[model samples]
Target: MDLQSDLPPLCVTCGVCCTDAFFRYSCVTPEESARIHSLGFPVEREDGREIFSHPCTRLCGASCTVYEQRPATCREFRCTTLSALEEGAIDRPEADRRVSLLRAAVQAVRQLLPKEEKIWALRARLYADPAAAPQTRLALLSMDILADRYFKLKGRRFFS
Candidate 1:
């Protein structure tokens, strides 16, 4: 049997975790770090640990290009929606709805700041400027609210 076929489809469509929605970087062991580097991913050393920022180079739009060879963090990480799905607390349709909502909100944020490379940087830029255009400010506020809602649904706190 194909066990993966029985799994929830949320992660297959949601790239938020890989795109730096919840974390700026993911840590990896030295060995995994070397492997990731060999795969051409940009890795950095922080406080004696190897880390990589998002959107991960290996992530190809909600899917990992190097899934089988992905680092332990990527292999093990699961969002709350995924957990809920696994436990039968939620069904696939509901999970798909939530993922869709998140994706829409993220798209809105991206549209507002098209040139920003990452979520953290976009948030920083928005927060740093109080005199931004009204539309920009409104977009930032909307993004903040959406991010909070997304994290809350994921059973976690919004970092920013």
Candidate 2:
């Protein structure tokens, strides 16, 4: 998803990200590619080297063929907040505040990026720095807390 800070509100029940086999999915590492190829899936050449398509044939409609054995990247990607925001489940003012905090945090981080990372990724470093202001730290914590429940991988989505 390019992992942009301002990515669109989560796909909701739109199921769009799952459809067309996630056209942008590309979790190809040499080892993983070799594993998929061993399963008899087509592995085509791109730029004279083989490229593995993500969201493979096993992705049946909105369902996964192997949810339990899905690759590491897919398992780790948690689009919780986006999904909640899109489903109209997040408390509006809180979501707005969290988003504002995120935007401000990203702006601050960009000045120091390539060294710093996503505000979500750099939460610890920023929060731990004594130099960070109290209000800023509080805002970061709010963002973190909001981020926590926005996506629940273990339960059904809370859509309204």
lDDT of the candidates, in the order given: 0.71, 0.46
Best by lDDT: 1
In terms of lDDT, the poorest run of 10 residues in model 1 is 151-160
Query: Which regions of candidate 2 fall more than 4 Å away from where they truly are?
Result: 1-15, 47-50, 80-160
Q: How close is candidate 1 to the true structure, as a TM-score?
A: 0.79
Cα lDDT over the full model 1: 0.71
- TM-score, candidate 2, is 0.34
Per-residue lDDT of candidate 1, residues 1-160 (tens digit): 7554676456667877787655788888876766788888898888888888877878888877787788898778766667777788877777777788777777766776656566677666667887765786676577557556543444555432
lDDT of 2 by residue, 33-91 (tens): 76767655566766655544543555564355555555555445556555555566764
Q: Give me the overall lDDT of model 2.
A: 0.46
